[model samples]
Target: MESLLECIICKEPYNQSNRAPIILTCGHTFCKSCVHKMSQHSQYIRCPIDRKFESRDLSSLNMNYAIVQIQEYERTGILAKERCKAHEFPIVITCKTCNIDCCPKCIRKHLSHDMYDMEHPTLIQELDNSMNGFEIKIKEYLDASFSAKNRLDKEISELDHQKVKLKKEIEDAFESLMRILENKKIQSIQQLDHKIKEKEDFLKQRLNDVNEQIKYYSMHYDEFQHMKKYYKESTFIDRVVSCRNVLRELNFVQFIKPKDINDNKLRIIVDTTPLIAHSIGSVSFNEKSSSEILMEQLNFQIEELKSNKLIYNKTNPEQKLSLEIQSISNFLCMSENIPELAKMHLIECCCNEILGYSSLKLSDHLKQELSKKIDTESLFDTKIQEYIPTLRSKLKYVKGLIYSLEKIHEKEWEKGLYVLHCLIINENEYDFAELYLQIALLRICSQSFYIINQFKVIDALPLVDLIKRYTKFHFLPSTMCYKQVMSSLRFAYKFVENQMPDFFFPYFKTQYSAYLTEMSSKATENIPSEYPSELLAIFQGLDSSDLHFWKDSDLSKQFLNKVHRFKEECSPWFQALRFVQERGEELSDFELAALERSLN
Candidate 1:
């Protein structure tokens, strides 16, 4: 009877002394004492059913009235002592054979049956142990359910994230391809219109010339008739004799409109295979159909282009601007795993739309707004530190957009670069002293170079100042930083040497070149010979064969130390070095020279 009203977690009966039953956040009921014990173990009580974080304090839990009612019903049985229903006597022993509770009087009727002594202390102890074991099994099942829920929820969240990212990538790629097609379409239509307008103007001029000649002949014929009717025969003959020279000189060349030459007319022959292949191509509209139906639809569209009553469901520029703003803002909310290809493609699409707004002074407005948001004084204020990370991420996004615009758009290139220069200078004010921030600045400078070279134009003074600020103040010559510095310098050299030769000396190109050479020699000293060609290109301008340049540099001792250290390491190259050192006596002079050079 006591087993029927116990807490599953503690296997203690629900009673006034044990504090009855209390419901947990997991919807399982336990005694108040057990809940307090759980709270003492951890700051939070994990729900056994789902592992959800729950309050540890027992005061917030509700009392289980259902368990109270069940306890009351069990307690009120047969006047405080359960008795046999059939015999109307106090129950003493339970018959094992008949599976019934019985009294001493009832046992006379069941003398042949086996029985259990209900008063046996060992049997009561065994029952208590069984109840305790059942409680443990119930807790185990709850824990297993909680773990499964956790794993499933995580998988569900990750899958949803991936689905969103994949959809976005598909949209971005198609948006770029659509822009390319629209530009091509506009170009083709403009060329066709120009050619047709030329022909139409020529025809109009010819028709006006023909009309003037007809009027000239009509006036002369009318004058000739009037002379015959109003003057003497001699006068008429004299006039005719005088006009004969004019009439003989009169020559009319008929102007016939030229036949439509099919070659001159635009005959759009679209290749349908590329569309089926789902790839980029010159053709836009294509169909796999019978020739008759294709021509009918084509002719209909050609006529439709001339119609003035057409309704255009075009998006307004303001609406497009808003949509683009939202799209770019989505980048900030994205937490992880954005592919570089997708980033470039999406930015290019946005830049294509932004090109139409060059007259609006959008870049200047954006720069002012961003700088205001990231004011130097506010960043140092005590209250704004928590919001610093969000502001930094948004600023980084803006810098990325500007870099992309400089690469892809022409008219906006100068404006974007100017804005980016301001942003880099602004960033320096806040994070100049930090090493990681300086590393980021180096990468920004590196990215800026490709765009500058691509457009073949720059505000050379600002660019030079920006580069000097990063490299001079924050010079950390690690492998990655070295590559970035050398690349930018190479682009800077090309930009000066080819495009702006006159701007070279005043902008410190010579000094920068020397700095790049030093960095290259240091950066490439420890690099293996099998490193990528891109890495090798950074050292291209710095002569690898210049023994004096390498030997005289400050990094030469460090390089020598590294070479010796490499020889001692356990690697394939080190094994080869070890073999050569072991067999030094057998090597010829040329072979020995080659081995020595390999270490250098």
Candidate 2:
């Protein structure tokens, strides 16, 4: 089975010293010199002879491991142990490398050997004695741990059973006691009623006896007065009758609704107001896909910057005024003219062909204007006001378009997805802030409003509110959603890196690292037994955890550069998140207008 051939170069019988060669694309042998020469060009090394590529660090190639096995049979002259690669003696060591096989004799020779026993003549004897002691201790600890765990488990099971039994018993006893108490109260009420009636009757009899005597006296007095004939117009008997009036009374009780004797009809009601931030704009879209839009908005100042640049001679050599960059800076708008400009621009783009017919038909004049130029103004339909009514309709159609695009992306774009990674730049100031806030509101509400079946392509990212929320929470978002968000981020990250790096600082760094780690762990944990190149790629650069650099208040600028590098390193590590990185909120004209409608 061993080599029955000769070496190509030497033309000699193959011996253990010489080995079979692996071919490379360069028509060279797979010898160390051949591979080493190719290493200087790239991190990946492809066999020039075979044109095979290993997309990993070439330095990490295990040449010893990958090389053909020993060319000859073992030299069987002596029963001596195999020699160590380094010491060239009978092996007697467990190598310092994470784990390696070694024999007893060579183990004591190497000073770096992790398990070497230099002090002892018979190291194996000493190791066996130490191992026996270690084994005894381990057994003792394990035995104690097992006993405790078993007792706790058994007790927990018993307690659970007892809890169930006691709960049932208590409920049954409580019901029976309630019935008994109710019966006793009813009987007591009956007895009290009988006693009250008897008392009332006895009292009535005594009152009647006294009343009869009084009646007789009154009659005798009247008769005597008549016989005497001394009565005037105001007689004595008439006066006495007028002075005292007879009294009649009956007891009444209040009525109540049926619930229980212990229950009351009173109810409690509370109205509380939430401390909600006033939104710049809101969306009728679902939250699932609006995350991308949210990220873009987050990266900028939202509304366009209107800084009036005023430069002057510093030394007053020429008192000259420079420039005035102006727009109404107030948060409460000065007028509707500015928004009109935005709307006009948006309409001009006409990016949303899925216009709502009803909204367009709101006014005959506007409908005629929009219909005249659908082809020319698709991407630039900036006026968001006129389209509010039909926003839902247009949104419905556009979303359908998105779904269609996803279903047949090849037919539609030829490219997997074509996205504007840098859309809607320069977000600053109250107006821009308002625009962005609206963008956020639009993003947050977009996916929440739409259902899975209602829209063609479901975008669950770039909703401004959701993006803000997600950034604050640091989450592993949906794959499609993340793709869209990454597009938004790519645009915004440019501005942040160039202009607003000071604002986000290390927060982006921290979150970026955390996101990569979480994504990688998920990839590794869910990796299949078979090859998972896609997942493996995601897991790369995730071994290192996020390194914090900023304190609560005092942070230097040095941390910023580090943070930038960290994010850059982690950016390509997760392909799942990257695949959908650029797909974002594709809002219809009416949908954009719908946001303005809620503003009022």
Candidate 3:
């Protein structure tokens, strides 16, 4: 009975004040304060008990007088009933027409109006029906609230985990930088100590020589004084010649003075400008919204596909490749403001797709896709056009390379060679540093054909010239292009060895020898300790009986070992070449085709 008088939401007993029971049109009652909170100061109110919406204003809603009377009875021993103002009697009947409660004496005021007794059985039955399943509704509401709270808690926990992970990454990054700085510091100090020791040793040796000279001069002076005091004039005259000879010899002696030591002091000059500019590192809030982060993640997946890590399989290989190209095209259309690295990766992927396909028509498909999707003007900045051209021009160069490979595949060697030569001649128009390696490889491939077919001893000169040029200007033998270049050169050497005895001997003895010397000097410190065996084999061939430039067994072996260890790592193409070479067989036709398409 006490529970029936309380509001289910606030669990407080209804009273005449803010907690006065207000009834909704749905026949559910709640305290006035809870109703106000539910209404949120609006005209409409939704019953929390039944979830039924009411359009009537909060002030217009009827009060639950039955619960109010019960609450009043609980507070006082006697039931609190309203008395008529006109006749002092408890109100019993309610007038329907006037919508008011009236006593038996005051019933004349609303006589003609319809009226009903306050204790009608029908009214009590309607009230009982209103509260059916009330507990079940309350439980549902509680369950929904708990679910929302659990979702919020999960989000907060994930955020905390991310914070900890980011903190550790920051610490690891700084720790790596600190380790590098410490190593640099130690190296610098060791170099300083070595320079100081060399200078100190030279100064000490000079001091010892100067001291000996001073002692000899003092003894000669003492001997001259003794002869003058104790010997006759005749003995002194004979000794004078010897003394003059000694004086002449002493005058001729070259003495290194303390002041003569030039200032060859070593001092370390550390440049902190780059460090000041970049600082240690930085952490800031990610400015991208949720939608933008999703876009970047999608773009990253496309990049993986472009690198050929994710395979796209279909019955027709050409169609499969075309679909992959179209995927990139679609991605480019949606995201106009892609990063520069992303754009480069896209171009590289497209090239790879075209190269992998057997059909010549896919190249045309790539061109069409690129033309439709890429925005030329927006991609290439006018200010930096010299360093990097527009994407269109880059694609054009790629198309030319593809065309040359096709011609080579068709056995149209002259046409293929012509196209490659034209590209190489106009290489400066493109990004030279980026494309130089490709052009160099193609030139070496062209020269390899001449060595095989023409059988001209002079054909090997261009190969030697090409190597000398690479060694002098662009010396990065650890790279895949460098490895391929050396491999091709070695093949050329083997082909003409029986015929041309000293074809490459002169260049290897002079220029090549000097290059090896330079590499050997820097091998211990700057250069890596592992290299491809193919690269090391080239130098081994140079140490033939005729051209024994590498004949110093002990020194040459150690130098070759260091160069071998310089870079044990190899790119995919280098590994393929090694696989073929190990079996004592030439590259397969497919391998050659792939080699011609190599961009890196």
Q: Which clashing pairs does model 1 show?
A: none
Better of 2 and 3 by lDDT: 3
lDDT at 555 for candidate 2?
21
Name the better of 2 and 3 by TM-score: 3
Angstrom error at residue 8, model 2: 19
Candidate 3 segments whose C-alpha is farther than 4 A from its true place: 1-147, 205-259, 266-289, 309-600
Q: Tens-digit lDDT track for model 1 on 85-153? A: 464355888777887878889989778898778877766886789898998998998898887787567
Query: Candidate 1: lDDT over CA atoms?
Result: 0.47
- The best candidate by TM-score is 3
**What is the C-alpha local distance difference test score of each model?**
0.47, 0.37, 0.52
Candidate 1 vs candidate 3: the TM-score winner is 3
Off by over 4 Å in 2: 1-38, 43-121, 172-180, 183-191, 210-600
TM-score of every model? 0.29, 0.26, 0.31
Number of clashes found in candidate 3: 9
lDDT of 3 by residue, 488-508 (tens): 554544444465447655543
Residue 545 error for model 3, in Å? 67
